[model samples]
Target: MKGQHVTITSEWTPREGERYVLGEGPRFVDGQPLIVDILSGRLIDSDSGRTLIQIDEPLGAVAPLTGRNGWIAAAGTGIALIDPDGVEWLAKPEVSADTPMRMNDGVADPMGRFWAGSMAYDNRPGAGSLYRVGVDRTVDRVLNDLTVPNGPAFSNDGSVMYLADSARGVIFRFDVDTTLGDLGPAVEWVRVEGGSPDGMCVDENDHLWSAVWGGSRIDRYAPDGTRTASVPVPVTQPTAVLITPDKRILVTSASFGFDQPQVDDGAVFVAETTVAAAPAARYGPSN
Candidate 1:
């Protein structure tokens, strides 16, 4: 399909309550919107502005665990399981402790394995890598040489994966072995024009929606890499994009780098849309 532009009015509404220093990872779990305050290491329920859990280090993203009580999260320098009792360390990737890196954007694939990426604190180029947590709880370094790795969003059937390297302004695609959690060669998918692509999600129509970190917009692209639509956001740093089941678009923004942040800079903003998202995947062996 050829690309077309769509308009979203100034009707974007920010969720009331607390603003985050770095708001990211907007997802729907059991029909409720959930987001993360990355810098503060908080997982929050977006609808009520309630803090679900708080970790000591940065919490990038989380996925509900199948047949389990809590969540599987990409936090700090590794992956961990967060439950009502407390946080249990899973596997920490072998990044040098002195280098100072943290986990970034991540999501559970359709086959229930979790994938996340890491980046250095100083934004050092070629100092980041992508990791995947298998169903057996083993961590594998999937890709290397990333700077600001933001996403590893998967397609509905888990046959295709899209990953974004924000500092490099590119998103790459990969073929996946869903049954075994193996990936094929990475192919350059999209080279973002105006802003760096941060977090992203795939919709029911097999279209990709990405949050433009410095461009103040959310971009929708067709499966063939054609830019289809753009949703203008009021905030400059739209960190992540989530499409709800009821066809509402949710965007998370960050206030971490601002000297004097705007009123809605760190808030979760929503707009009614006509496109719905694919069912979110959980992490675990049972699935």
Candidate 2:
């Protein structure tokens, strides 16, 4: 059932830091928010504005390794592991250089499998794909013929997955085979109307929260695919949303397409929310 509209304009305030050209992938790890400056390929601590690491290519997202002191990240053309030493490539797409695709949003599922999606630089239709990296470090193309794939958020028990095709303004739901990390059939879940969905996260109640790129808002959806609430954002482009463990909402924005950007256009914003989020799942063996 649809609920009353809740506008949250006064609660949001920008986090201290220099603005980002393309700020994205807000994830809470060890009680701190880690964000990515996508085009710059820099992963940063949102609170301190400290660069954790910067690579030569675009960095989409990262998840902490379960059994090691490092990170498994969706970067450039494939997935890589980052540590104090340096980055070691785990897998790369087989597509030729002429295709020119780069990784976008990604995360590790509750079962510790890493999944990432990629899109062509030119935004060509049907040129994007979603890949899954298993516990044994095998990369498999799970879905193809996508344009601007985002989110791919999962349910708490790893039984369901939700993915958005931003360019198509649609979010899809899928059943997951938890033991084998195989997806069942894709079902149309939500077709966004006003704004294209960007990045998303699932809350403790299994509700999905998405950052709407062009609508100046973040939307919350019930598990049954009903739009229940919407939180207004100060910036025009809210690239991603994270529900912090402390029950706060963290959003990353972008200044990429704006000619005269607002003061908070590319800033990270934080808000106090009633909902709580579980800690992100780590990549690798579960202890």
Candidate 3:
């Protein structure tokens, strides 16, 4: 059931062609909110509607996350750690530089492994894969031959992992082996008939809150994949969702493919939500 609207955070709009503000990653790390502007390489503060740092490099996903002093960013075909000095590539992607493939959405597991999904720039089928970065800094291609792989949110206990193939309009849950950082066979969790599921976040009660791209709304799902709640946003392309440390529900939107993008097309919003924050932020390596 849809609920009443709540107070929104400071409103901000994308400059231009800047879709999916949280397309890469948006999560609170150590009490600070971090958001990645995937196409522009803008590291936004998510508070003052300001850009804290901007790099020329384009990234598929940025884990508004860090192990200690640096961030884990999926650039081109590899994952890098960005800090005060510079960037360091921790793993090299398997595909060649010429491939039309690029990363999409990603997150860290409670065990501290970074998981990222990739897709073709032209939306070609079976041209993407999901990669896992171990704590030892090894990159492993776990899932292959996919299209538009989105969320990788985990259960509270880290026993289950929720993954999505948006082009199919479905999300899957997998049994996870936290010790080995491996994913078991996936079972259908939810099938969205209205809009493709994009990025997502897990709440305190083992429910999934996902952004419905092109649906102009966000939906909440139980562990068994049943719709429990929904919320409407001001944009048509709400790419991702997140909950800040202070308990405000924040959503990220995009402006891509819109003929004449409106003022709210690329805006990030705050809405009413009853769920608290997740058990803890995704794990990462120590300093």
Candidate 4:
């Protein structure tokens, strides 16, 4: 069957003087889309269209989080636990680097572990790596020598993991070991030149949906990495994507580094797709 793609337009901007300069992570929380304003360090409620919660200013830019205690977020230096009421506190890992790291794309695994990556500001190769943050706040590096690691989505059955190296324009797949929480024998799942891969999610049928940053569109790929469909956007820097419970797809864009026509262009759009999105996995409780 052929996949369907649609575009939803934005209705509101974030709080005054607020914009998602990086704008990547978007995750479903309690049937509602909860996203992070990467620049302002705010957690936004897609339904109310409000900055529902604000993390402490010291944490740096935050990423959309899904955790057992109702919320989990990434900071410029670490991760944090958030509650339904938007109360949050740092979930500092016992083992982490001091070489100026910030969490990027991440997802909660079937084992309830949060697997996230970090990258340098300039998207330099070997400047960042992937890490696993357990429910106990323990940190372990899974892979290294990565340049702008993003996406970090798992298959429907949790048997495989899909990640992207944006600068290289390649999506990688790895055998997932849930018990040991390890990624093994990684291979290039797909290599799309000319465009960079940003955020992604898996559909109910297990197909991978990736947002192409410079391409201004979202590309759907079969489990084996075949192009299934493409959904274009009006924005130049399309960054992240999320499929709602009702099977609607929402996209967030960035006006960052754009001129007047583009600055007036930042928007959050939504559209319905033929493929149903997989249910979101809640992060396991703090141990």
Report the number of the highest-lDDT candidate: 2
For every model shown, what is its TM-score relative to the native structure? 0.95, 0.96, 0.88, 0.84
Candidate with better lDDT, 1 vs 2: 2
Best-to-worst TM-score order: 2, 1, 3, 4
Worst 10-residue lDDT window, candidate 4: 58-67
Regions of candidate 4 where Cα sits further than 4 Å from its true position: 1-19, 56-70, 84-99, 261-264, 285-287
45-126, model 4: which lDDT tens digit per residue?
7656688667653222233344334556656655666666664444443126545556677778766777777776666678
Winner of 1 and 4 under lDDT: 1
Better of 3 and 4 by TM-score: 3
Q: What is the TM-score of candidate 4?
A: 0.84
lDDT of 3: 0.73
What is the model-wide C-alpha lDDT for candidate 2? 0.90
Those runs of model 2 whose alpha carbons end farther than 4 Å from true positions after fitting are 1-10, 94-97
What residue pairs are clashing in model 1? none
**Model 3 Cα lDDT, one tens digit per residue, 1-287:** 34222223343334333344344366776666666777777777665557765666666566544446566777666677777888888876734735666677778787778888888888788788889888777888899878888878888777899988889898989999979987899898899977889888887777788999989888888787878777767788888888655766878887777779877777767654445665234437645
Where's the lowest-lDDT run of ten residues in candidate 1? 1-10
Encode model 2's per-residue lDDT on 28-140: one tens digit a residue.
99888999999999999999999998999899999999978889999999999999999999988834645789999999999999999999988889899999999888999
Scored by CA lDDT, what does every candidate get?
Answer: 0.89, 0.90, 0.73, 0.69
**Which residues of candidate 1, in runs, are more than 4 Å off?**
1-10, 94-98
What are the per-model numbers of colliding residue pairs?
0, 0, 1, 3
